[model samples]
Target: MIFEFLLLVAIILAIAAVEVKDMLYAVLILGGLDLVVAVLFYLMAAPDIAITQIVVTAVFGTFIYVVAVNRTGRKEVIE
Candidate 1:
């Protein structure tokens, strides 16, 4: 039940992340959704993949987001 809930939440977050107009918000949501997926992987007993995903999504992904944000200011409103 909890696993299903987590998966549902992850899916919803992933969809929202993609649909969001704000790039920064979308990146943040993507990272969050990725973390959720990693947790789900862990719950499913895939520790190696979970750890890799967690590290890549939380660390590397955030770094990429920061670089992108720095390259392009976040003040631009997206419609």
Candidate 2:
């Protein structure tokens, strides 16, 4: 039950993150949603995939956000 709820929430958040116009908020939410999916994967006994997701979300996702922020300039705000 809890896993199902988390999965649902993760999916919803992922969608919301993608649809959001604000780039920073979208990137943050995308990272969070990826982490949530990793947790769900752990709960489902897919430790390998879960670990991969965790690492990717923690490392690559942050890298992407940093690159994006650098390219866009920190002062610019997306509506």
Candidate 3:
């Protein structure tokens, strides 16, 4: 039950992240989706993988996206 819910929520978040127009909102949503996946991994008894995903993708990946967005300005830069 819980696993199915988590999986569904993660899928929804992934879709939302992709559909959103703002890069910062999209990055935050992606980070949230990553956390949901990490929880799913933990529930599947893969603690190491979950931790790595949390640290590597959820944290660092989000940070990198935020930095990139900041450097380029929050809105899309069109020439």
Candidate 4:
């Protein structure tokens, strides 16, 4: 049940990342989604993958995205 709930949360986060207007918010949502996925991986008996996911995706990826957003601005410029 908990795993299923995490999956649902991940799905919701993904959708939110897509729907959100702010690039920063989307990056944060993706970080959350990655965390949830890491939990799911841990629950599935893949501790290594889970740790990698948290370290690589949740941490570094978010940092990179945040930096990019900061440089590029939060909102998309429609041409």
TM-score of each: 0.83, 0.78, 0.91, 0.93
* Error in Å for residue 2 of model 4: 1.2
Best by lDDT: 4
Candidate 4 residue pairs that clash: none
Measured with C-alpha atoms, the lDDT of residue 60 in candidate 2 is: 95
lDDT string, candidate 2, 1-79, tens digits: 9998998898899789778877777778888888888898899899999999999876798788979877986554558
4-63: candidate 3 lDDT, tens digit per residue = 999999999989987887889999999999999999999999999999999999999999
Model 2: lDDT of residue 56: 82
Provide the lDDT at 69 for model 1.
81
- Number of the top-ranking candidate, with TM-score as the measure: 4
Candidate 3 minimal-lDDT segment of 10 residues: 70-79
- Model 4 weakest 10-residue run by lDDT: 70-79
How does each model score on lDDT? 0.88, 0.83, 0.93, 0.94
Better of 2 and 4 by lDDT: 4
User: How accurate locally is residue 25 in candidate 2, as Cα lDDT from 0 to 100?
Assistant: 76
TM-score of 1: 0.83
Q: By descending TM-score, how would the candidates be arranged?
A: 4, 3, 1, 2
User: Of the candidates numbered 1 and 3, which has the greater lDDT value?
Assistant: 3
Error of 1 at 18 (Å): 1.3
lDDT of 4 by residue, 1-79 (tens): 9999999998999999999998988999999999999999999999999999999999999999999999999997779
Better of 3 and 4 by TM-score: 4
lDDT of 2 at 3: 90
Residue-by-residue lDDT tens digits, candidate 1, 14-42: 89987887778888888898899899999
Query: Worst ten-residue run, lDDT, model 2?
Result: 69-78
